[model samples]
Target: MGRGLPGSISGGVKRRGLPGAAKEERIVVLETENAALHLKLAEYQGLAGRSTSEVLQLYSAHGQQQKLQRTSVVTQLHGTVKRLKQDLKRLRSFVLELSKDFQRQSKTYLYQILTAVQGIQLENEAMQMFQIKAFDLEQSLQEVTERYEKEKQKRRALHNSLVELRGNIRVHCRIRPLLPFDAASGHSISEDRQRNFPEKVAYAADDETVLIKCSRPGHASINRTFQFERVYNALESQDIVFADVAPLLTSLLDGYNVCIMAYGQTGSGKTYTMLGPQLEENFAFSIEDESELGIIPRATQEVFRLLSEKPPGSYWVEVSVVEVYNNEIFDLLAKDNYGKVFGVKREVVTTREGKSDVPLLMHETVENAAEFLHLVNKGVQLRVRHPTLVHAHSSRSHLVVTLTINTIISGDNFGTSWEDEQTSQRLNKEVSCTFPQKMRENKSTSSSRASSPTQLEATEKLKKVKTRLQLVDLAGSECVGMSGVTGAALRETSYINRSLSALADVLGAIAEQRSHVPYRNSKLTHLLQDSLGGDAKLLVMLCISPDQKYLTESMQTLGFGTRARQVQRGQLKKKNFPVPSKAK
Candidate 1:
């Protein structure tokens, strides 16, 4: 049994070894097949239809991949086509509606355009009618303007006649614009107050009224209004002023004594209104500044121009310049012992004939306006002027410029000169000795002309008509505190105030019809006796500043002007007298 077991074990070992050999043989066969596949890869270059390439690829068929992809692509293309057809259908509908809207809107706009055209045509026709009406209105306005101008002239004439009959002094107010020195005129102006208040405080309310507006911070506002015969605003030129004053010159030429005086506060343009901005001592009247010429220079020129139209030497004009300083009259044309012209103090005396005269007053006969202005310039050099808080070239004295016109008439063809004075007292006395005798002469002189050449040639009687034109520039009223004057200027202020007060008192007396008109109260009143009391046409010019600093002074000036306008001195008696001509 042992022997048989050994032989079986050997047989089992042989069987196992034989199985191992068979497995090795199968692996060798697989490696050879792989090598052959590698050779096929080298021949085809790892891809089909690549003869020179060496490659090997192994592909497997899917279930339906290409068919599924193509199906998806075709489905997407169908979706796109369906969306395009829907979009085209929507676009066609939108286009059709857009065309209909365009047509509808075009019709609407065309209708509106036609309606606008019709409306424009109607407006054109209406405009033509309106233009015709406007033309008619313009023509009517032109006619009315012409009529108004004519009525204005007639009204002016009638007004003058009424004034002449009533014998009321005409007052004109002039409101000057605010000036720099106006603040200096008043010491009350402070920096804070100046900032609080506006500059212009006074103005012209109308052609005949002056209004003062006193508005201040934390103060009761006050407003004052005044009326006068005429009111000139700041915008008015000196020419406009002269135009109104030229009529007085006509009265002067017609044998009427006329006095034109300027009254106002210091730095209120009184001097500028009278003597002009050329009040300087060395001022030369230039034609370039012709528009700036004030009343005095312009009057001088106008008088000469009027005289030029008269017959040669028919009238001789003698001009005299006088200045009142410290209540004393000084002849500015007076000659000293050295033949040098200086202001010679003169006495103003009331004559027995109720007329005022200045003895030894130098009157220079001027042939033309040039000579007259030249003499005035000389007098201005001698006139007293000092720097004040108000005005830099303030006039400290009153200036009186008198033009004495002598109407010389003799034979019908011949002329006579003023060479004969029967006595030295003739210069001091009027032509007539008494008022009643003057009235008789006034009545008889007119009838005497009818008796004419027969009676005139038999006696060889010559007549001379004398008239006086007095233009006065009064010294401005000033307050000592406001002017800050000292020494001589203080004295001047005192005199000036007193004299102005006296003038106001005289006007009050006249306005009240007092029997005793205080004409002799001051030299100013005494000098202006004829103009104030006697039969003479007097015009008062009230000048005012538009500054609040001068409000008080402006009110006072306006008050004075108001009182002056109320004085009715009886009908103006014509000063027509035939003085016996000097027998040559």
Candidate 2:
């Protein structure tokens, strides 16, 4: 009903262009006239009754009501159209405001994007610059490393020059630190007012001097100062002690006998300085214990390193290990008929040239440092040792390790000549089962002469130049009461004390220029005869303890060192002649 009037009113307004009230009046007049016509037709058809006029009136009233409804519908449609036009105007303004906001946000977003792009470009350039600097730094590091290596080599050469200028004998004193065992008790000390426990009685006054402060009851206090080639304090490291001894290696290769001997009282660091301190009670060594290796291992490594710098195959090395136990010499490397190593009796005979030689000594040729140390470790395992009160494992024998370096040089290099007939007589007296390396050298000499003079000159010019490096670890002097030994150890200790006495006697005689220096009194002195009496470079490393308990023995050791330093041997005589000075 609502849609019908609005649609018809819209069409009527469009067609006739009528106002609202007038359109309603015209619709009512047409309905009244139609009702009257309907009444007349009913009468013509002979169906008119009294109620026909009444029905026509009712029909007119119904039509009049429909006109009012159509009028109200037109009014409502006009108001609705006006309200829709207003809402459309407001919506248009809102859309324009939203568009402006979007434009401002897009502008800000574009600026942020530009800034981020610029920052990324700067970062890329910085990365490239950093890479360039890293490469430059790497190159500089490599250059520094090369210079450091050169400096190390130069330092060794300069120090050896100073050693050569010093003299033939070098005596060094090392004062070890106070140990835990210096006190009578390990964990606690007694409340005695007489003796102070673990006190430092010796000190290094300077780099070359040691000062000892001695005070005895009812005796004038004695403050003694001794000068040595080098005095190392307890604060020094093993490397520092070896630094002074390293120059001797160069002298050994230069055709001179070099001897390094360690002498000290019992509980002193005699074995510790020669070999490293062994923590394990057994004879095994760990792989990571390189820093703990002592003078012997380091010297062996240095020898191989120096040889590596020389021409390949120009030199041969042989090693011999011997121990003096209870005044007898036993070869450590000597084997039985079944090819197993055992102690064998060896005799030290004085040659016609007055040099001592071990004829039946077992000589092992070593190709590298590791092999040499392995053989040494094997021999050390077989050494005789027993635990004492002061030391856990005290070495009861004196160890001697000799390294013989055979160098071949031109005959004209040194004035010494080996006549062909003389060398033959000496070679013929040798036993058949000699060292393989020595046999090879002797056989090479047999093929010396040739038809061509060039070949003969070549053969004769090659003379065997042999030099000896003797590393000796002498048995420590013992205090009978302190060592607390019984049956077997007491006897070994007696022998050790006597041999040390013989060494001191030889030094005393040499200092006084006696007609007869007693070298054959003990086996230790006899074996070291050439080094002590001949023109060999000798270094006696005196290891002492700062413990007040062993003060007497320490003083005796220091006194022995003083005597060794007083012996004025002549300048070193190398196989090759020394460079003549301007005076010559």
Could you tell me which 10 consecutive residues in candidate 2 have the lowest summed lDDT? 442-451
Angstrom error of the Cα, residue 474, model 1: value is 0.9
lDDT of 2 by residue, 411-513 (tens): 4435333223443333333312222344445221111112356445545545566788899989999887767787999999999999999999998998788
Show how many residue pairs clash in every candidate, following the order shown: 6, 0
Error of 2 at 563 (Å): 0.3
Global fold similarity of model 1 (TM-score): 0.72
For model 1, where is the 10-residue window of minimal lDDT? 440-449
lDDT of 2 at 538: 90
Model 1 off-target regions past 4 Å? 1-98, 120-152, 182-197, 217-221, 279-287, 411-460, 577-584
Model 2 accuracy (lDDT, Cα)? 0.75
Candidate 1 lDDT tens digits, 391-509: 77778888899887766444332322233332323321322321223232322111112334544454353456678888999999996656778899888888888899999999899
CA lDDT scores, all candidates in order: 0.76, 0.75
Query: TM-score for model 2?
Result: 0.63
